[model samples]
Every structure is written in structure tokens, then in C-alpha cells.
Target: MVIKGLKHDAVAYNTMIGGFCRIGEVGKAEEFFREMGLSGVESSCVTFEHLISGYCQIGDVDSALLLYKDMCRKGLRPEGLTVDVVIRGLCGEKRVSEALEFLGVAMRNHEIAPKRKSYEFLIKGLCQEGRTEEALKLQAEMVGKGFEPNSEIYSAFIDANTKQGNDELAGMLKKEMAETQMPKKQE
Candidate 1:
């Protein structure tokens, strides 16, 4: 296209970057990302999201975080999936504290709210790290935001309640879990 005097736009760059990232060719994708800017195409949130996902997919959470900060510096509000993937990556790396901080900063302040799945990931991370109180608070906030806890969340709540000797809440969650899992009777 350069030979034909057609400059690559954001769409073309995004496609190439996403394609490379999907194929485990993040290096290639980064090359295209650099070329995109050199060609004067503005990088959008989708572009950063794809590259960040590629980094996270390859266990390069640090690079992904750097990219995330860069995106923020450029005034782009990352999409929900981007936040979710980053949280997953940080949690997977056993960096729950850092992930929590990121969630507080990026996800909390972003224009598009992170998905419930993102909250679930953070809750699981906090639970795994034995930070039950913080996890409970996060779960409470999640509930207040109109997000229903999933099975895993129920398990977390049950454990926390039991540890705190709050048998009432534990039993309630148990009953709720049972109710949710019960099959409906046919007429």
C-alpha cells in the first residue's frame, strides 16, 4: 500500500497487530505498532488492548502493564476485556497486591467499567492470598454494583464466614448455593 501511496490507517494497523498477537507473534505486532505511529496513525484503545493481551498471554505482564500505563498517559480508556486480562495476568503471576492497586487506579477510574468477571478474578486472587477481609470488601462492592456472585464467589464467602464464626451467613450462602444448583422439576 505504501508503494501505491496509500498510508495505513488505524483500522489496518489494528488488524495487523491483532492478527500477529493472536498468532503468538507479539514481536511482529510490536513492529507493526511502531510502524503505525511512524506512519502517523493514532493508536486507539483497541490497539493497546490487543498488544497488552498478547503480552499477558505470553506471561509478559510487566510489558502489558507498561503498555497499559502508556495507554492511560495517551488519554485512552481501556476496554473491559483489557482490564480483565491484565488482572488475570497479574493474579496468575502471584502479584495480587499489584493487581489490586491496578484495579483501584485503572479499572476504578476508567470510563468503561470493568466487567464482573474482572471483579471475580480479583476476588479469587485476594482469597488465594489469604486476604479475606479485603476480598470480602471487594465482593461487597461488587454486590453493591448489582453484580451477583458466581459459584466460586459463593465458596469464598462461605469460607470467610466460617472463618469468622459467622455460621449464620455461612449457612445462608450454603442454602443459596444449593438453591442455585438445584435442577427445576418438570410439570
Candidate 2:
């Protein structure tokens, strides 16, 4: 298209890359991304996000992580979706600990706020992995971040604690759930 005098701006390049990625041609997407860089078109956060999502969709989370680090090094702040994609990919790989750690670092250092769903995925993965203590801690952190714990999350924790004979903690979670579900009085 540029050969025909169509200006190959970042948006045009990003569209081509995104199209290739959507069709499962991540290799071609990477090629176009590199070519875009060579053509002096600055890559946007959206460009990196497309490639990150493409790598994650293929279960190539390592590549996605590398791309994430590269994006960070380039000083392009990742959007919430970008962080969520990488976190979800990590959880899908059963690397829930890594996901949690990454999320913590991103939140503390980069100030990236995760979507509630990302926390839910990590918590579920942790519970499935029998890391109930860590899951409880994560749930507390999520609450501290102002995310309300949904029933599914509460139930998962309750189930885990109950099965482990931690009735006290399970009861506490139930009480907390009830409190969260209560409607607050308007000031």
C-alpha cells in the first residue's frame, strides 16, 4: 500500500498486524511489526497489545512475556487489557504464582490496575492448585483494591477452606461475603 503512495502510519501498520494476528498468523504479524519499526513508524501500545494477545492465544506465554517486558522497556505503559491478557495466559498455563507475582509488581511499580476478571482467574487457578492460603491472601488484596468479591470467588474460597477443615476461615469468608452483598445507606 505504501508503494502506491498510501502513507504507512502506525494505525495502518497496526491494522495489518492485528489482522494477521487475528487470523492466527502471529509470525506474519511479528514480521509486519518489525517492518513497521524499520519503516520508522512508531509502534503504539495497541500494536504491542495485539502481538501480546496473539502470542497468548497460541499458548506462547513466554513470548508474550518477553513482548511485555520489551513494551515496558520502551516506556509504553500497558493498558489494563494488556496486563489482563498476560495474567490470564499465565493462569491458563497453570503458572498462577507467576501471574500473581507479575500482577503485584505491575500494580506496585507500574500502577496498572487489573480488571476484576483477572483477579478472579488467578484466584480460581490458585484454589484449583490447592493454594488456599495464597488464594485467600489474593482475595484480601483484591478487596483492598476496592474490588467486590463475587459469589463465585467467595464460594471457591469457602469450598477450599471447608474441605481443608479450616472452618473458621470459611466462616469468616462467608461473613465477609454477606457484608459485601448488603446495600449501604446513602449518606
RMSD, every candidate, angstroms = 3.0, 3.3
lDDT of each: 0.88, 0.90
Which runs of model 2 end up more than 4 angstroms from their true locations? 158-187
User: In model 1, which range of ten residues has the least summed lDDT?
Assistant: 106-115
In terms of TM-score, the best-performing candidate is 1
lDDT of 1 at 104: 79
**TM-score, model 2 to reference:** 0.82
Residue 148's C-alpha lDDT in candidate 1?
77
Show pairs that collide, candidate 2: none
- TM-score of each model, in listed order: 0.84, 0.82
Which one wins on lDDT?
Answer: 2
lDDT of 2 at 35: 91
lDDT per residue (tens digit) for residues 43-162 in model 2: 989999999999998999999999999999999888888889899999999999899899888888789888898989999899878898788888898899898889889888988888
